[model samples]
Target: MNRRRIAVVTGSRAEYGLLAGLMRLLAADPRIELQVVVTGMHLEPRFGHTIEAIERDGFAIAARVPILEDGDSELASARSVGRAVIGLAEAFERLKPAMVVVLGDRTEILGAAQAAMLLRIPLAHIHGGEATEGAVDDMVRHAITKMAQLHFAAAEPYARRIIQMGEDPSRVHMTGAPGLDAIRDLRLKDAPELGAELGFPLEPGPLLLATYHPVTMDPTASVAGIEALLRALDRFPQARVIITGVNSDAGRDAVTGRIAAFSAGRANVLVKDSLGQVNYLSAMALAAAVVGNSSSGIIEAPALGVPTVNIGPRQGGRLRAASIIDCAEDDGAITDAIVRALDPAFRAGWPNPLSLYGQGDSAARIAAILAEAEPCLIKPFRDLGV
Candidate 1:
């Protein structure tokens, strides 16, 4: 049988982790030929040469389009997107894929989808119809939703929102968050062993795992927010802290600079560009509390039955589990939230915590849908209610 050729794009390590299970599913299925498009931070050395990480997973990349060039400013980022659109369109023309599957909200996917749209290739998007009030990806995600022919939401409400935006309800599928696929299927390493692997030596005390990004709504506050979080963390002098680097946002310099300078001599702190997917998820599972503006605190932590102290407005309007403690981006507020998340009495209340997302089998469902949804030119705008 001539398999359906589907092209997949991954630009960063984080989204690659989320898409891991589904990629494997499509690769092994006899009906789908996976065309991997690798770009963005994956090709950059500073972000950890993540393309190598992707290759290590046994998928042969079909295209390596380099678009970024020292993206330290907004103009550079815009130019990079233009380059991506041009490069990605060429990739689409060559591959002639039946469909293009892109995930999450990032410049990489946005530009890739633009290329697919102009080439009249079918586009499928994941993690659509959600809100992230403080970040730039909020707008990026909605834009991708408009371009997509099929939408896979991690939650039901998100699916409804896509329909509200005039997308056909039939094209929207609630398959849950793919990030949990690793949590449910992978054997996450325990604290002491993971600590040894990460070189952090997580002692017998509370561990705070955090990853903060630049809030597009107010870039200036990104630095101040991290400072407040660090000050709050300082209150727990015995706490073991593991911090991953910031994403490629305009004002990211301030956040990483603060982290590097603050953690320079702190014996209890460890900072890195990345810990890979397995090590990172293992760290999350073993952590005393997941802290920061990351959506992981909202989606992954609750599923792991771990407490989350979500600081600031980055994840402002997203659906959350009952175990989440939301607080302003202030030292006192963050400190108190962390304290509350660590309280035994509060922890006792969530003996059977549940995720608002999914049961972690989204990959198989997504793969099946992609193999069947062939490319087309006539995608009439789906009405608001029909």
Candidate 2:
């Protein structure tokens, strides 16, 4: 009785949080052997060395690929991807899993997809067919969709897009977003508890859970965007702001520098390297609004009944819920959006926090699918007769 081996690659802390639930299900399945590949920012100290968080979660990491190093230049990112390909190639060769699974569009996953394609290991992608027009990740996501033999999308619209891209319809599954599972299962900390944990007081004003990343399409957007965001945040002095670390993109250093500098003299602001999944989601559950361009604002916040002020184009072209207030990168625009998200009247009228993505059973669905899926690298282009 040979257990089906499934390899899942996680790069950053945020991506790991999304994949963790599915990884757990896969690990528990008697018919499955879960192979965990940790890489990228997880290995970087400045990003909280988040691989330890995965270890703490009890997932046995099969490979620790250190593809990222110091420096956030475009050249550095390109070199890192190259290293990921070489390293992941070797890992896949050694593990020889029936299928390789990866989530979303990231540089490391790009490398993973390439290696899997060349190695002839069946590839499955989660969170594919989503678009982020303002970021380079949009192209990467589409590229991965083509390479993957199995596509598990977070929503119907995303699944349709995956099919539109010539993927065989039978292979695509609308399994919802696994991120919501954390919100459903975790015993999230309440406001008082979260405040105590973060060493902040949640009384007297709104609490903002903010996470901003570099808009990779525009090199100058990160510095300018963080500056504008900081200025907008200054307007709401009564609010407590929790700013998390940026992704390991090309412009990360600029954004992190600005965020650190802004939080230095501000008592109302707290800067965290990584909140881990539980504390982060717990904070979101208690936040006045999830403020940032991070996808959490667009996906998980609505499910948690929290409003979101999504700034800039980093998450552009992705589906948004009624609770999300999109704004330009300008300080005035951001301030206005934040005001809208915090408005009691607005939330009062906002519909049932309609989860555009399905409910929280995504991880279980994906795990069952992976356990039963037949691994085959030979796929034919699907055509929809007009």
Worst lDDT run of 10 residues, candidate 2, spans 346-355
Write model 2 residue lDDT over 1-386, tens digit each, in one string: 89998999999999999999999899998899999998999998888999999999998899999998569998999999999999999999999999999999999999999999999999999999999988999999999999999999999999999999999999999999999998898888887888888798776668888999999999798888989998999999999889988999999999999998899989999999999999999888888998878998999999998999899899998888888898999999999988888889888877775678889999999998999988988888878886
Relative to the unseen true structure, what is the C-alpha lDDT of residue 243 in candidate 2, on a scale of 0 to 100? 91
- lDDT (CA) per prediction: 0.88, 0.92
Q: Write the per-residue lDDT of candidate 1 for residues 134-189, one digit (tens) a residue.
A: 98889889999999899999999999998888887778899999998889888889
Query: Could you tell me the TM-score of candidate 2?
Result: 0.98
TM-score per model over all chains: 0.97, 0.98
Per-residue lDDT, model 1, residue 198, is 78
- After TM-score superposition, what is the CA distance of residue 321 in candidate 1 from its true location, in Å? 0.6
